[model samples]
Target: MAFDWSVEQIAAAPSITPPTLHKHYFRERKPRAEVRFRVEAKLFTVLMTETEARNVSTIDKYVKHFERHDACVPKSA
Candidate 1:
């Protein structure tokens, strides 16, 4: 699923800021699998990537994201 919302609305909804720093809401009943990594810096950052369970092999689903980030971008299909 794809979601696009404004920061203004997210901030007002719920969070941990003066007005509350709420960003997004994607409450899945159960996540099929997950992959997490850490970025070392002044402060460590955790990146959690996930996908839901499906009967067939969704290679395309995973393939598209290979271009989603600069680090994961592929040269050719």
Candidate 2:
């Protein structure tokens, strides 16, 4: 994944593991500007075994629900 290298780089710089780096910066446990950038830039990855995948899935589900709702609602003229 594209973020793997970035994560590794970040981890190396901080002397931490990639997963820990992800937990602190990439996970949606807290709202962060960098997280939003990752989402917008498609720089994040979802691993099936990790909690990040579940978090990402939750965000995706909400986004899809809003998209459906927007499609069903009429726009104001």
Candidate 3:
């Protein structure tokens, strides 16, 4: 979904410093695994609170896009 949160708000949710998030996540640097998890968790929390069908779909799209090229780390055998 199109979030109403500003960069400051988004950064706040994941406990990331605004400047770091802007330079990393917003500026196209791939976030570290921990940062990615926190951000995705925040988005998932938002998705859980959404009730509209269309908005849920939109949020799903955002999650997928965020996860692009970043598969789950494989378990050690």
Candidates 1 and 2 compared: the better one by lDDT is: 2
By TM-score, who's the top model here? 3
Tens digit of per-residue lDDT, candidate 3, span 1-77: 02224567878887998898877776444445555676778877777667344576777776787565344434340
Model 3 spans > 4 angstroms off: 1-31, 51-54, 71-77
Q: Candidate 3 has what TM-score?
A: 0.38
Clashing pairs in 2: none
Cα misplacement distance, residue 22 of candidate 3 (Å): 13
- Candidate 1 lDDT by residue in tens digits, 1-77: 11122445444445434233422334421222221121112112111122233313344444444336435434451
CA RMSD, predictions in order? 12.4, 13.9, 10.3
TM-score of each: 0.21, 0.29, 0.38
lDDT, residue 24, candidate 1: 30
- Considering TM-score, which of the candidate structures 1 and 3 is the better prediction for this target? 3
CA-RMSD of model 3:
10.3
Q: Flag the better candidate by lDDT, 1 or 3.
A: 3
RMSD of 2: 13.9
The true-versus-predicted C-alpha distance at residue 34 of model 2, in Å, is 29
Error of 1 at 32 (Å): 23
